[model samples]
Target chain A: MGETIDLKLHVWRQSGPNAPGRFEDYTHYAKAIPTHASFLEFLDIVNERLILAGIEPIAFDHDCREGICGMCGVVINGRPHGPRKATTTCQLHMRHFRNGEEIWVEPWRAKAFPIVKDLIVDRSAFDRIIQAGGYITARVGSAPDANAILIPKQVAEEAMDAAACIGCGACVAACPNGSASLFVAAKLGHFNSLPQGKPELDRRVLGMVTQHEKEGFGGCSNHYLCEAACPKEISVKWIAKMNRDFIRASLRYAPPVERKEGYG
Target chain B: MASSQVLSFTRTAIGQKALVAVTGIILYGFAFFHALGNLQVFLGREAFNQYAEMLQSMPKLVWATRLVLLVALITHVVLVVRLARRAREAKPAHYRFEERMDPSEGILRRYARQTMLLSGLIILAYIVFHLMHLTVGAVPGLFFVRGMAYENLIYGMRTPWVAGFYLFANLLLGLHLYHGCRALFQTLGLRHPQWDRRSFAMALSITAVIVGTNVIIPIAGLTRLVGGELPEDPQEVLRTGEEKHTVSE
Candidate 1:
């Protein structure tokens, strides 16, 4: 058995969307957590103790507990997903924390992401931005052979790197201005790099950027805090690319003119 | 259709950023040329006065350039103000126990990036004071005369308070220029990974040159290193229109 370590957790607790939140001390319940356990498991142990004491368990979101779902996240000591760089909250192990350490956990903070309860926030703002133009209209009926469309190796690698963004909203949470530029840029770059996504590049960038502004996200000031906080390690170069594409599209790409079918 | 498209474009965040970048380029260009022009003060009295005379010689061209610069400054300020406001509104609630991650860009770069608006506004105020003191000659307690650019500059900077203000404002301008130069390229989508480091170095060098020359001019004036001796009787000198002594080469 791994050595157990004591910890003090100050987890954010909010009753509802309109409710004011505060950090609730779980020091007593969080004692003797196993070092081998994940951060989520430590939370589970604390919740179990809370339930036995006839108290409401901390309401937090988690699924798969494997980090790929991008569901589990909390601002542990002011970082989006604890201190481990590029690792999600679920993947953060308790061993990273020292004995008698104090942990402060809070939900993602952004106007677009309202706190639902405790550490869970409504990240639907990201979805709406995605829905604006994050996809291509190209109809690929089935999974075609990879060699059929010969994407250059470098382009494929870059696209894959950009595609690694899991839509976790960490970029927004970590951004000083609460800008979603990195996230939007990642989505645009992922599609724009590939030939299949080239046909609608202008539409995708314009529509998504327009929606991003409408959602009340701040503009990118190139502080690159989002790049630092991103779990996937997406680069800010994509933002530069997005800016380029947006300008090119705005200047030259005109929308199709509407035609009257019967009149005139 | 084109007009509506232009209007709608300006309404978007990227469009606003593009406007800021374009204006920033104009203002930066003006600053660079302005700094080089002001360095003529070190060339002694006659040379500096002749430089000023040449500038006034082309009144129409000078006024047109001024008009363009004024419009660019206004556009830059307004768009950035809107951007900053939206940024504040986007993150309405503050984190009770927030800790910013260490940026990959060094601390100085981070400080410069965060204080762009603050430095920019201060620089704007400095510009007005600068014009009033040196150009319009409306500043109180300064010996003023029409067509006396060289005399006006020396008189203005000889005052300790006025020279201090110029130094402070020029330092902030340096901070503003450092971030503005780097960010403008990024905003305009002109940055490339291959030469990103070179670009940052270029920005620093440009900022240093402008700030160094600007700061030097005032310090030179304060120490009497530049400019001819001030005549004891300003009224007599104004009436006679004669130099008290030739500036040492």
Candidate 2:
């Protein structure tokens, strides 16, 4: 049996989007939590106790509970996903904490990401950025034969590294300026590194970068806090790549000239 | 059509970042060469005054260089101010319990990175004061005589308050350069993963050289290490300057 430890949790509470929020002390209910329990599980225990006492339970976002879905995240003790490197909040276990320790939890803070409820933020801004140009145009036919593209091993590995980003928004939370450069760069790298994604490389970079700026995300000053806060360990190198590509595309990619007269 | 394309390009955030990087390079080059040129003060009155006269002889070249530096300085300041505003807007709210993820990072790196704007503004103010004190010789109470470069420098730096201001301003400039030198590469999309360490080393060396020479000049004057003896009359200093110029010619 795992050792059970008591904890003091100061969870952020917000009734609605427009409501004022504060950290509500949960010391009375968060007692005897198993050390093996994940952070979400610990929250569940606290919620269950609140529900039994005829009080409204805490509301937070979670899915899959395995850190793959990128849906669960919260700032704990001022760091996104707590202090463990490359571990999401859902995978953070209570064993990492000592008995009777106090944890302060808050939601991701950024102008682009608006608060929807307690511990849940409106992340539709990410969707808008992706919609701008996060994909390549492909034919709607039967699947192509395997290994036809013939991507080199190194290139494929690098693309896979960029693809490891889970869109968790932890990078935004961790950045002092709340910049989303890492997330946008990872997406650009994932697509631009592949042969199939090369045809629209210039357009993709240009569109996505402009969209990111339009969404109120800050520019990258290379502080690299995003790399440190990333649960997927996405490197800031992708941002450098994005920057290189953007400069090249802005210079060389000319817009199509307008015709003065139409075909008769 | 071409002009329109250029206009549209500059409107993007990346475009402004590229401009900032390019202008920063120009300013850095000016700082480096300016520091090296000013180091002639250590060689004593004749060498230093001759160097100043040589620069004054080429009026066209001096004005052209000044114009370029003026443009670069203005562009750098304006773009950085706009970028900083955008960054502030991006994060309208603050986290109540925010902490640095990596406490192991050096305090200098943290302080320099986070306070770029603050250091930059202070350095800009210093530049204005510096131009007034040395270049234009318009500061009241400081001894000034036209073309007496060596005497002006020695007399100006000997004052305790002026020397102290120079020391403080140069230290802030050092901090600004420490981050600016490294960030320019990233801004221009020139940084590669393999060259990260080398780039940092390059930035450190450049900042050290520029700051070292600039900081020492004032200290040299303050401690009487340089500037042996100044003639009481301004006309006497001018006579010596012209004599050296004629001899060199």
Candidate 3:
């Protein structure tokens, strides 16, 4: 154990997304805190203190503890996933903070993401958007050889860039407009840019964008904040690509004409 | 799913944005030509009147353009209003003080983002006032003779308040067009990573040309830079009459 750091925290408390929420303050004298302890680890220490004091422990959501799961996200002092760029809340180390520092913590603030509890928001809206058209239609069969597809290096890299989106709701939380354009764009770009996904490109874009709007999320106005807040540092260009595909899909495709009985 | 539902576009945010983008392009074209046409004021009353008369002569063309523009204006206004409302609703809670995470964003970009809706509404009001004063001659004493476009324009702008309003409105238009042009390209799918800066540059340039020329006329009128008094040459007046006759014939 390294030298311990004492700190103060102002955490938001809400029973649900639509429920009334308020900030509650707590003080922790971290007697055995490690300098390299992750932020979540620090929180764990606080939760233990509350449990010993016969107080209800703060509720939050976390999975792998590593940055990959995208399960943990919180607004630390008004920024999504804390002050670090391209870093998740779970990965943020306590060394970034100083002893006796006061931090304001809250869950993601957007109509699309309802708060489930203290510092935990329901991000299931992302799942609905993906369900609309995030996947390419492929027949289940034996895996094909990697060399058979032969994708260009540049194209493969671009696809991978979009595929890096961890489906975190940080983009929505960070956007001034509460828009999910970046997330939606990432999914669209990931599939639409790949050769294997080309056949269903138009349908995917149309379905997803439509579902995005139906989800009651805000529209993007090119603020570029989503790119800045994105843990993966996804490019904002994906948004423009999505917008283009949407317009083209809108005009180029129509349902097949129905035939009258015996008319053909 | 119903085929109609599959083909639907405006039901989505992206679809509404594409609609705004296309209509914006149409309006941009009209604005560019309108500013150019008004630039004829510096060429003297004879030339300016001749230009105005030529436009008025083709009633079919004039009416067609007006009809298209009217439809575009209506569609743009309605869709933008709906989208703005939805965006406002999307954020049920707001920060006590909002700050961008990116330090690189400039003040101008922030201004452009925040004032888009305000500038657009101002432009809409300006358009109505403009039509009343210039097009319909409904502004009693503000606008005089209908056939004398050169005098009407100059004399109408002689009022400092009207001239000031024009200058203010033109400034807002410049801001609106600056953002609109770049977003329009993106909405239309013309964006490429290699050409990212080009969109901003192109948008700024186009805004400069349209807004620069448009403002010059009002400033020229207010400051008496073009000419203090309307052209009074008898021969020039006779040429205008002949030009009008030719246009009508």
Q: For residues A186-261, write the lDDT of model 2, one tens digit per residue.
A: 9999999999888888888888887787788888787888898899999888988898899998889876567777
lDDT of 3 by residue, A1-264 (tens): 666677777777787656888888776534456668888887888789889988788888789889988888888888888888899999999888887777788888888887777778778889988888899778879998999998999999999999999887889988877899999999999999999988888878888887787778988877788898898999988998998888887788765577899987
What fraction of the genuine interface contacts, i.e. the true contacts, does candidate 3 reproduce?
A: 0.63
Error of 2 at B93 (Å): 1.3
Per-residue alpha-carbon lDDT of candidate 2 for residues B1-249, written as tens digits (9 for 90 to 100)? 122323346776778888988998899988999999998998888899899999999999999999999999999899888888888898887777755678777889788888889999989999999999889999999878777788999888888899888998898889888888888788788888789899889878878989998899889888878885865455676788789889999
Error of 2 at A235 (Å): 0.7
lDDT of 3 by residue, B106-175 (tens): 7776677678999999999999999999999898757456778887788767689999999999999988
Residue B210 lDDT (model 1): 94
Each candidate's DockQ score against the native complex?
0.49, 0.48, 0.43
Docking class of 1: acceptable
DockQ, candidate 1, vs. native dimer: 0.49
RMSD of each: 3.5, 3.6, 4.7
- In candidate 1, stretches whose alpha carbon ends up further than 4 angstroms from where it belongs are A257-264, B1-7, B228-249
**After superposition, which runs of candidate 2 have C-alpha atoms over 4 Å from their true positions?**
A256-264, B1-7, B231-249
Interface RMSD of each: 3.7, 3.9, 2.2
Each prediction's whole-model lDDT (CA): 0.87, 0.87, 0.83
Clashing pairs in 2: none
Worst 10 residues of 2 chain A by lDDT: A255-264
